[model samples]
Target: MTEIQDRPAAPLATATFESLSPITGDVVGIHPVHTAEEVEAAVARARDAATWWAGLSYDARATHLSTWKGVITRRLAQLADLMHQETGKPHGDAMLEAALAIDHLAWAGGHAEKVLKRRRVPSGLLMANQAASVEYRPLGVVGVIGPWNYPVFTPMGSIGYALAAGNAVVFKPSEYTPGVGEWLARTFQETVGRPVLQVVTGFGDTGAALCRAGVDKVAFTGSTATGKRVMAACAENLVPVIIEAGGKDAVIVDADADLEAAADATLWGACSNAGQTCAGVERVYVHDRVYDQFMSVLTEKARDLHADASPGSQMGPITMPRQMDVIRSHIQDALDRGGRAVVGGLDAVGERFVQPTILVDVPEDSLAVQEETFGPTVTVARVRDMEEAIARTNATRYGLGSTVFSKSRGMEIAERIRSGMTAINGIISFAAIPSLPFGGVGDSGFGRIHGPDGLREFTYAKAIARQRFKPAMALTSFGRTAKADQQLATIMTMLHGRGTTIPKD
Candidate 1:
């Protein structure tokens, strides 16, 4: 008999913790801290479920996903409550994040059939007698390790796309936000009537277990240092990985930019979610012409923002405790290097929450400029021109995402910046468009999680060719003629055999 995947309530408490509110340090909820063995079990079940799920046609998979999306949409408020309790983010922010995730889910489900279905290709005159086609096949099971920042929107970049591509998912959310992960899996099971998606909650070790649990691929969203470790762990099983790592992304404002819009976008990009975003704007480079105006607007906006554990606060506590130290160090480094804190100063970092901070005149080599602070801190630097802004923005090893605010040269300057997605006249808005690929290069990691790239990431390309007829002069058999050989040479000469551009002897 096939055993059902639903677990008994008795074993739920094997891992327990007090999820605290970042603002008040009070227990919000108690969640399970799953073990490595538990994570392996979840993967094992997901692997079994994937066999059944992947066997369905692309259209059938789409229908199943649509049903799941409906469930998510209807019960979004309930899910958002759990997100709020776990991460201490504002309820509205959680809802916005969930809404965006649902949008991606809907897009992924509706489009996966078209993107992944087999398609025919031209065989060329040389192979006219043969039929050729390419199709994408599922990789069975995918393991996802999520981050606490933007919990729903970020991991869904992998989870939704993977499900749409017809692969089962085993997710291990960050230790700081396990309840949200559990809620998602629970709702998925209730709606789909299967364990196509499952959660294994724990800290880093549990996540590591999921990587080595014989899954075909691992999609990780976290710091760059942790991303490297995740890649190394997956390497043990030869598992493919897509890492969405840390970013020191910058916003470049040209002399022709609308200073008001640029300042607003820059402030939100650096302060939203307490600047816990992976692709959030950490630095701003404005042309000297409007530097003063931008700075004034930014500080005024920063002053109005507040970080508290309260439900209505615009910002929340740093989800991870250790990150507070990193935030403090960045502020201290900026201060020690003669940078002036235009708004919140060194005391901005609290036990769990970090207040909005704006610094100016920081040296280019300071930690605040070079490293990812991952907090609500922005270093505003004045650039001589757009060229200097582009150069300074590209100087970071991390190139996850960026923003540009220029009237005429927006796209031109944006394309020059070394990042994955660039938002013009906005901030981090490209991630909402399902057609654009999301991921980064260099230290920010490779492989995408949304769009067609996301659908293809969970699948491998399969090519098929079949001979339809025998050629007049068979090239592979012993029936070839001299005339055919001469014709082939003529074809080669007409193509790649022409005189080299370098003039070959």
Candidate 2:
């Protein structure tokens, strides 16, 4: 999910629409263009379904989710094929995406009890007469608007966690992959025997409708521009939203790093899935000591990769036709600004697929550097030291994810980057780890949709403070006296008035 997905179709009402294959321009699937009324109906049904679903114990819900996980695992190949037809990604990439999603679903189900369940907290001396505890309660229904790229994995980040948290979901998949959305929903219904998960297939109107459909929350993933619009719609109803939006992720390579490994990771991270990943590597900052050598290895590998309709090609066609213009414009902007293309340039932009492109010496303000290209393109810049590299890496307004390559300084460098997740000596490793929360800061959007944070994202905290005994000072009652107030002040002074120690990370 990133800046490269298809923008929403204009709000022209239609009965049905066809999902086309980007590789062949053939209709892959036809789905009804659901209306606002229809979307409301689905959410309404989800509201009822959520009540019953939430009533079950965490273990019972886990069992149901675990069963659904098995079903998806069994039909992994089938789902992969549907994804390939709709998103034009390689079958292997699709399979990997779905497989990771399954892992997350399993983790969400198996761990929700521990992460979201009620747990006791120590009552301070001031409140010693009470037994205090806190738990996360499910928001009735969550509206999930997913992106076309990595359709299965991205949406499930929200859908799976929300369900595991005991909320029903109304998923509105990208208009480019309605079939995939329906398939997920249909399979869940077959196993759960209810509307715990439902799909509403349509264009942007349907998504806007979901925000206003009185759902407890909405989770959105797309371009930053689209995210703002989604937030506005959700705000109309004062609904909470988790937006996993666009990113211009970067990678920093130090002189002490493994050059060959960094080259491979950079090329793969930049070109894989046609570079539509929200967390995909778009900018590279290498220590000048190893910049030339690193470029030699990176370009050599980039040359071996090409975007075609080959059944087994690791690089596939651009999923959205409209996005081609943005890709071309970014490339042209860098070139016009005096950046030299080392591997590919304007010629690499094709009708459907884009060849892996590497540009060097691009200005920091160039579109290819400042914006999310959402294409198989990368910009390389040489820096004098790790200090310069870190500064440049953190310069972008978008910080969804980042990578740092340094044998001794990997962890240190990773900690300094302004990204939600940083992979040190690895490529997007945080995504595969279900316990790590995945999201971004600044313009990359807010909130999270993975791990414990993800499970709580669709829930409201419920704090319970039961009275165990009468307090010496009745602060809440009118009977509270001046003497009691003095005692409270004295207790506060003793407990918190002095200097305190901050715990170390």
Candidate 3:
């Protein structure tokens, strides 16, 4: 039996919080700080809904998800505008994010039946008389705690897959992006004609309540420190969890690489979304042979980029205002520690936006290099070779996404990086592929949130073995004679008498 947390009775709620726009600090929307009791009630409702939803055939569930996909795709612009207002990202970026999420939804719905359906398996020689099979069953209800960055694409990694696997979901969006969460649930309800997906919005306490709300599984995407807390909360109920946490991702530029393309991809990966991306490039290690040329190109391209909440802005304001201080501290620490800023530095961080800041010659131990400076800032370091580049890149506690820009050895170098996803000759493109599983290792969190692994993450595997015929050798019954036991031993010896030896590759 699974152990449950000792949850205290939640008091009635009379409090509320407002989602403010990060750009102008204007109120985007108001929502309640749902109590533990309210969250559990929502879970209870989801549990009931899950039974009916799970009872449907995979094709039936796929149909519903497809319908929801159409609804979201049709209103892509509307949702993107809402996302822009709440998160302060450019409309085009928001649309791209939403479109990618929609694509994932389609993939999850279209492939779930083939991926999760029961299938037969060989029973092996020892159990030749039995027929074996396995199938993945829904875990009933799932709780997702989403991050503010890439609000749509990130959370849907779990949400879309969980629903396609036949579980009802209750999502808790970040305090800064609750409206986006509400809009998603509302649209899903509109298409499905049921509250299969629900939203609970508020601050940290509200999210904590969701953690203790007795859901079967929890999918959390946020900072590493918060991921630890979420893991602890989920431990109370022995519930399974998937955490997509912080990253200090790096980009490697080999001597033989396309220097211009490498610099362009790295800059975009680092500065796009105001550098709020978890998988965004925060570090770059270039081979010493071409370090000078790479830096020259990177600096020139970065100088042309800017962050603003106004129209025509390629980058927008930081979604979370508190992040400004963190970004400023990192830049200041880097500069004070003998690092050189080629483009923007301490002055780049403003009231709401952080301009593209490029730091070069920063110590590997510097906070800007080690920690997740989730603003549009990146630290570039020189390395002697690809070996040193891989070593330096893997030295961080984070093991999320990484990039390699080598014409011949991109995949070879990427394979050596201790990260979950690696982009070859590109930047953060793994998230765009719906078939790829996305997550991280070590401090970056565990379990996956996309593809077949994601569909299975919110489910339990049920295995069955049926006896097809009676075996000639009866090993389980007392009716077995001494001669029968001897014969069985003789047969076992005949099959395993050979000594074990290592095979030469």
Candidate 4:
């Protein structure tokens, strides 16, 4: 068997397996890890659902979505528990993510008609008499390959918007979180009384199957290497794709910043979810003036956080075992290159749980700074000024999200950064606004998954033009005369042949 097939859920037959708790290693639930055949079947069912869904008026779809939102709200605790069990995130964090997703769902459903309705446009002076309009049409079926981190919020960014835009969705959740995927689909089906949104669970192969299952578009979220593979797979069918890949996002602290708040935001951004977030702050550049103060505060904050399998644990296991090795390697690289660990260091990584780690004075080229460790580890560097901090922050190829903690220069530094979203004063708060677009640029991947842009990503632009009246001069037929041609030339000359002074009344 391939190395991927030998992972945690390898023995399942129909892409079905038991989800184990990352902390306790206990089997949480059994789920089906769908194969290509199941994905095709789900898509076939979705295609029929899409036809009916597309025929419905905007109000009708909104009503169904409202009902689904109510169902999710009623079972919020149940779903959050499943999320926490499968992904090993804090219960409050899981609930917060789910609540935000529901908010986006409501936003998408309420605003889709306004954002995508037909609108008139000028046809330019040459065709001023003719009327032209543009509208967005659904692309039929959309496939979403979700990640394990923030499983609900991330995938719903695509699924909720796709459905609001009158498209059916077939989602393949990460193997580690298939139970959450199934829970979402079940709730949706219960509310809508149709498989408008279906779930197919599996590892990467099942995700690959969804890409090739003839869907109109695919929205994938994962590592950069895996995104490339997903893109190549989708390219085989010429299907459009939206990729929300990984990031080594950085946080910048200026001389005018609040050292305590900066330390709090940085620690939360770095160690949250055991540091498995795509937009997690993995690197930090602090002004030299507050470097010592920020480090001292961060060390204290991180010390209070612990990764355990208990109910009230702030941090949990790494979820994926192999990721432990990568996290270790990154910390080791930083240490070997003369970096000092102010908190948990190389010994922080255990068999499952990874302790919160904070490294200082790490070389820029070290793996901790250059690669996505995706663990409870962060690297902090001291810079002379904001310019140096911004320059070093923008040097990485990944620009998914960043945090700026400057009181006076927050906006200035945020605009100069090469990331898609920048959270000033807070870490990753832009994701909650529902108005700002979220996605990365360059190697971090392209296309957005939230707000109006998310609604449009699952659709195609359709333009329509109709002639309002025939022109006064019939130049199409053999009716053109020399006098008419001379008149046209005179008009052209007066309008554009040469620049002229403005006429005085």
Candidate 5:
């Protein structure tokens, strides 16, 4: 999913990469392609800063994070403009992404104390003389390797929560959107007066180096293949990592569902960001009773929308250039496998943009259905019943996000799907809530981000056991007498004798 890749470092002080605008193929900016040495240096600085940052009280940290959030909120349009240039998503979409991320930042800062602060626990009868307590402690420095699609929102799910939990972060943004990463670091530096949030720009080497640079944890967002590599790199140090990778998210429509509402949500979820969303709807399983009506409404609305760089276009160009080939290939394969294009077909995929494409009768084994297209295309299939729909939805190896649209059985069906999160009657609503965790199971990758889970991801649990008084049993002392042993046997027998099983021949 990333455009830039690993290359040998130049002999100069620093090598660099050009960020290209998907709309015009023009160079938007040039950023340094940091080497392994530079990544290590950044981690060293972050490790030092983490000590000072973690020393501050939770309320103090919240205040500072709020200031940075205010800065981002005030300059939302500016960040959105950069996002549109690098990612080529619509201005409004870019704004919305950054806005949601900012809200998460605010929530992380405001709720860290309540979610992470130490608390007391009851001691058991045998250990009544002991007091037990537990709290989450910060893991020094965190490395974040962000994805190009939804660059701001995706990485901030890690960066924001990690900081709120009292850790310094070193972010390695996707080579495609390095400027946005630098902008965030620059602003945080000005507001917080430290390098608590820093940026390292480069390609795959930069990210791989970040993982080996001795950070406490690494949070990554991208393809499932790349996620495995990240896991391997961190294995040497046993560094805990959270991977927010791609998904072939599906939507299930029951016989009792609202066809019009379902169609509108499906189209938006599929084509909104030109289908680069990691959790965008890629497959639909509709009950046979409402299949025709749902398809009729979906295709009609899809026809009215288009992808282009032209002003006021609802959809924007594909951010990564190579992804266009993948998009087109999927469409062609679906058509070759006896799928009917009820809407735009292969002709819909252009050099930089892809119009909405809806396929009917697509085989479940086809690439368009089995893999992550990451394009503005969807496959619709008719199911015999709601049970069949649920089975088909859970068939994919990816289990990230899913949608269930049913008036009476929405919750029931949603819970049945094997995904990290599900939207009962909405599209991607779990991501916006900030309290529900976002992630995947199986091939979609592991670990979670967002909510209390996210705040705790960059931390480790520390437990405390305090002895309040001497135990009457003196179990650990060699001075125990025969009477003590008899008493212990009596206590055990009294507790479990009635439940013991006996066999008499």
Candidate 6:
């Protein structure tokens, strides 16, 4: 085993933890339980590495990132397999997740220079004599707390972008998938020949340590409850944080939607990766005219899907065993509230897997509809029209991602839904697009981690205004006269004294 160098000296107890394969509950790897002091040391080393990284020219950084990207792309299968073993996701789903992450890496590397380089800004009439420009500078070091579900893809959203923006990253992956995180760091080290990216493995205490380790910024992805805790920890140091939290995402079906296509997308969105996705479709609203037909098609499609570790399975076991109880509770609550399970019910949630479950006529206030089940379950509800559909979709405290299926009103309805990203006639397609930003609002958490905004998230804007010529009125100087002040006041009034009005009124 190639141990990560610079690990803090072990204490007397020398505690450790094991990463277990969710599929078989076998030990995948054993790692030390890094303490707060160790996490702080890692960040301190990252601070030094960040200086060297940020000092490199944009082309130099891009070249290095490109090399790392090529290494990951060529060995995509190897990484995907690790993702599968750690998260218990199907191999094909792991591949898709890794591929999307690779694409984002490429985009972040190729566009960092263009996005962060200094550029001139309009000085406006107030500062016309000054030449003003703004550029993004890398924050010294960034701390990343990753989620187990979609381990590789989710963390890379922050890691890749942060590196592209010229910052070193210290990542603390979820305990359930520490092996995957270690593999990433090892590969990155091999490609870059430096500790520009490092991993510290442990549980929640390790994550909280990273937040308080004096990093310039922290990017966290997990549940909303955990996100709040992460934010509170970061608050101790007044460190900035970008939180990608949980969501109760929905899919809205319009009367004019392609019923077949909508049903297919809804089933896949709700059951893919065993529906552990934070932005997965948990609640679906269909127009009353097509509700029955859509439900029939969805139920039939879901019936064909199964969650298991067996070969060629459509889904896999829940990465976290505790989530099984949550899934069962939601199903039971829905049933107790007079809802009927169209496909699978409470029994669908087995020891490690949650089968495809579709509930109908679930009350709007039911936990199945109001909370994130984080399992392969969805509640189908009827709406009188698109108006009600939009209203119901926006009723949740979480606004992460949503989907819409309509022929003419797809974009229109999507616009009305309050979410960070909305896919029309597609399922979670925005995540694969490199130019579009990904994040959420309200309880889903705030801050983006992809696209140009993602690059800037790990950086601070530095603005410079040089005096190109002396102003006619030296308003800012002690030499300014009362006459000049009067003239400036008159100009200000002339520019903004009048408010425009409608002629007809």
**Full-model lDDT for every candidate:** 0.85, 0.92, 0.88, 0.89, 0.90, 0.89
Candidate 6: give the clashing pairs: none
lDDT of 6 by residue, 278-365 (tens): 8899999999999989988888888888887797998998888777778899999999989999899988888888889999888999
Per-model TM-score on C-alpha atoms: 0.93, 0.97, 0.95, 0.94, 0.96, 0.96
lDDT of 1 at 261: 89
Full-model lDDT, candidate 1:
0.85
Backbone clashes in model 3, listed as residue pairs: none
Candidate 5: list runs displaced more than 4 Å: 1-14, 478-486, 493-505
TM-score, cand. 2 vs. native: 0.97
Cα deviation in Å at residue 93, candidate 4?
A: 1.0
Of the candidates shown, which would achieve the greatest lDDT relative to the real structure?
Answer: 2
lDDT of 4 at 232: 91
For candidate 4, the lDDT comes to: 0.89
Error at 19, model 3, angstroms: 0.9
Query: Which tens-of-lDDT digit does each residue in 261-293 have in candidate 2?
Result: 999999989999999899999999999999999
Q: How many pairs collide in each candidate, listed in order?
A: 2, 0, 0, 4, 0, 0
User: Which numbered prediction scores highest in TM-score against the true structure?
Assistant: 2
Clashing pairs in 5: none
Stretches of candidate 6 off by over 4 Å are 1-14, 500-505
Query: Which window of ten consecutive residues has the lowest lDDT sum in model 3?
Result: 1-10
lDDT (10s digit) by residue, model 4, range 12-101: 455457789887889998876677788899999999999999999999999999999999999999999999999889899899999999
Which ten contiguous residues of candidate 1 have the minimum total lDDT? 1-10
lDDT of 2: 0.92
